[model samples]
Target: MRHLAIDVGTHRFIARLEEEAAPRTCAAFLEMLPFSNQAIHSRWSGEAVWVPLGDFQTGLDYENHTSHPSRGDVLLHPGGLSETEILFAYGSSRFASKVGQLAGNHFLTVVEGADKLMDMGRTVLWKGAQWIRFTDLGER
Candidate 1:
C-alpha cells in the first residue's frame, strides 16, 4: 500500500508519501520531491499557485469554515470531532479540497508533524483497483 499525507495551512501545504517500494524518511522524502504547481481556484483566471505546508505561522488567527468570510481569511481543515483531531482535521480538509481539481498536477504544504494522517488525500489518486483509503476533508 502507498500512502500520501498532506497538512494544509493558510500559507503552505505539507506533504509526505509512503510506499512499499521506497524507504520512509521524512526529511529524505521531502528533499527529493519538487513543489507542486496546481491551481487553487479552478474558475479564477490567474497564474498557478504553489502552497508548501511548512510555512504556517504558529500563532496567527485564521478561519477555516466559512467560504466567504466577512473579516478574516478562511482556513479549511479535514474533519475531526475533538481537539486532538484539529491537527489532522485541518490538513485533511485542505488536501481534499484541492486534490480533485488539481489532478495530474503536483503541490506541497508547509506544516509539520503530518506523517500519520494517511486517511487524508486518499481519494485524490487516479482510478485503479488497489487498496485505497480516503479521509473526507469535508465539514457538514
Candidate 2:
C-alpha cells in the first residue's frame, strides 16, 4: 500500500494506492506525485470529486477498470475516449466521461479519516472548485 495525501481546501484526506491490484496505474500515479489541480464537484457522478491528471496516460495499462465504484475508490481513467482524470468517490458514484458510462483503474482508496467524506463532499459542492494536491505521504 502506497500512502498518499489529498488536501482539498482546508480539509485533508489520506488514501492508499492498491499497488498490487493496479501495479501499472499505481506506478504511474506515484511518479506524478505532488500534483495540484482543481477539484470540482462532479455533476454526473453522484457524490464524488475529480481532478485532471495532467498530460499523463497509461494506455490501458492495468486497466482493471470499473464504472460502479464504491465510496472512496480513487480511480485513474486513462485518456482514450476522454481526458485523463482522477476520480475521488466519496459516496455512491458512477465513474463516467462526457461520452457516457466509463470505467477507470481503481488505483487508490481512502484509508484514514474516512468519516470526513461527507463533509469533504459538502465543502467542494458549496464552495466551488478548490485546490487539491495529491502526493506521497512520506515526501512531506
Each prediction's whole-model lDDT (CA): 0.24, 0.82
TM-score of each: 0.17, 0.90
TM-score of 1: 0.17
- On residues 33-129, what C-alpha lDDT tens digit does candidate 1 reach at each position? 4323221321211212223233332222222232221111112221232110111222322222322221111112223333322222232222211
Model 2 scores worst on lDDT over the 10 consecutive residues at 53-62
Task: Give the per-residue lDDT of model 2 (tens digit) for 89-113.
Answer: 9899998767898788998888887
lDDT for residue 45 in candidate 1, whole number 0-100: 11
